[model samples]
Target: MLALGLNQFRKEHFWLYHVKPTDPTTYAAVGVILLSIALLPCYLPARRATNVDPMTVPRHE
Candidate 1:
């Protein structure tokens, strides 16, 4: 779902998309936008997450 949404968004916005196609500029713009959108989820923070202690490691005794 997320993948589809971001893809459409990129095509519409950054690409200045066209119906006939064959425009290199539009294609390049779309590609760049899609890549950026794909990376967005990896970098964004969770809405309700709290910071954990740096010194504490999980599953280690």
Candidate 2:
């Protein structure tokens, strides 16, 4: 992703984001957004998995 971003954008870009430059807030926000996007979907399945009774899971013969 770092390499992809670097290749996608030019250095010293006028926008808030630039390939060569590093911004803590930018990275933090990006991390949070991506994490939310990713983890939100799995929350339901994760919760359900935790609630499942192992003994009730049917065993294949």
Clashes of each: 0, 0
What would the TM-scores of all predictions be? 0.43, 0.53
Worst 10 residues of 1 by lDDT: 45-54
List CA RMSD, all candidates: 9.4, 4.6
lDDT, candidate 2, 1-61, per-residue tens: 5744684466546355442355566667878999999998999889989987777778632
Error at 60, model 1, angstroms: 8.0
For model 1, state the Cα shift of residue 45 in Å: 4.7
| Residue pair clashes in candidate 2 | none
Among all windows of ten consecutive residues in candidate 2, which has the lowest summed lDDT? 12-21
Writing each residue's lDDT as its tens digit, candidate 1 over 1-61 gives 3544567555655445444244566667889999999977865654323465545646454
Runs in model 2 deviating more than 4 A are 1-13, 16-21, 59-61
Q: What is the Å distance of residue 35 in model 2 from its true position?
A: 1.3
Stretches of candidate 1 off by over 4 Å are 1-20, 45-55, 59-61
**Cα error of candidate 1 at position 23, Å:** 0.9
